[model samples]
Target: MADRLRSIAFAIFFYGLSVPIVLGTPVAALLGTSFMRGYCIAWARLGVWSARHILGIRMRVEGQRAAGPALYPAKHQAMLETMAIAAMLDAPAIVMKRELARIPLWGWAARRYGVIVVDRAANARALRQMMREAQAALGEGRSVLIFPEGTRVAPGETPPVRSGFAGLYRALALPVVPIALDSGQVWPRRGPKRPGTVTFRFGAPIAPGLARADIEARVHAGINALEP
Candidate 1:
């Protein structure tokens, strides 16, 4: 009962503060990518702060943090990691679906902030466009973050990495850093979030140029490392 109450209060506090920031997204876009990225990062940090204080959730990152241009394929479990990564990484370019990119003012800001939008239905054409944008982001010294599973999975689920990940790996020609986390244990896809520590475990980086099967196998194991 207490946890439920805390979750409700956290939601109210967080979203209430988020209104003005969401409204300012387009204006931030006009200031250029740097300012927009910072604005987004600040909002992410705000989420982290509220989660810690109001919801009693904390984050712990284990293993080496990647520096420079690399591919970070993370486990998709909940919305927490999405905000957490933005707060943690150094201006990462997150790969999100076109549906999200189609959102009103938020979508405009995301595009201007340089998020790599993937159109799953477009197949090859979409893959090509994603690679082009990813390469451009790397050139700007930003790491690309993607959830290979494509969508959030409940705890204990082991879904195969989507085909697009390997294609992006081959196109980017960068080492892959797999991030495993069990956020769903607390911040589940549905239901009230519980108070607990969410751990993100970064596995060893796999060198680029591995065969599709090999890279996919390694990443599949890496991102599920934290799973019981």
Candidate 2:
């Protein structure tokens, strides 16, 4: 209960500060393109920093940054991992849930950073939009991250990635890098949260030949193989 209160308090505080930060993104974009990448991910760094300092969570990252930008297919245990990676990765482009864009500060800031948002229920339009935005981001030499599971999974539960993921891979034709972690066990997905180490291990990039039918299965196996 103490841990939960701390985590919740930190989250609410972060959200409170985020109101003005969201509107300032447009101003940052207009300042210069150099400010663009940093502007996109700065709030993420704040959230991650607060997680570590205020809530006492630590993060470990594996795998080196390769030459070309690739797509990250990560397991969604808790939302903290995404914010942590936002600060850690080199100018990463995010593919996120469409509803997030509707939030007061986060949504506007995310769009300014070129984070792709998709309405999972609107299959065709959403996939097309995600691919289009992803291609543009890759062309600009940025990495894109997506959660194939499409939603959060509780500890010990399996995340069955939707077919929408395979379609995104096939359409984008970009390298898919799988990130496996046991973050949910530490963060506990908003229930009985505890401060501890959450490790993020990056697996090898999936080759182009990895077919659609096999993509989700491959990602699932990789995430399951991580430490429990």
The CA lDDT at 50 in model 1 is 91
What's the distance in Å from true for residue 215, model 2? 2.2
Once fitted onto the true fold, the runs of candidate 2 whose alpha carbons sit more than 4 angstroms away are 1-5
Candidate 1 residues lying further than 4 Å off, grouped into runs, are none
lDDT tens string, model 2, 80-167? 8787777767668888888988887667767777888888686676678888988888788888888888888876777678777787
Shift of residue 57 alpha carbon in model 1, Å? 0.5
Question: Residue 221 lDDT in model 1?
Answer: 98
| lDDT by residue (tens digit), candidate 1, 1-228 | 998899899889999989899999878888978998999999888998998999899999999766667899999898889889877786699999999999998888788888999987767777888989999998998999999998899999999999999989998999899999999998976778999999999889899999999999999999999989
TM-score of 2: 0.88
Clash-forming residue pairs, model 2: none
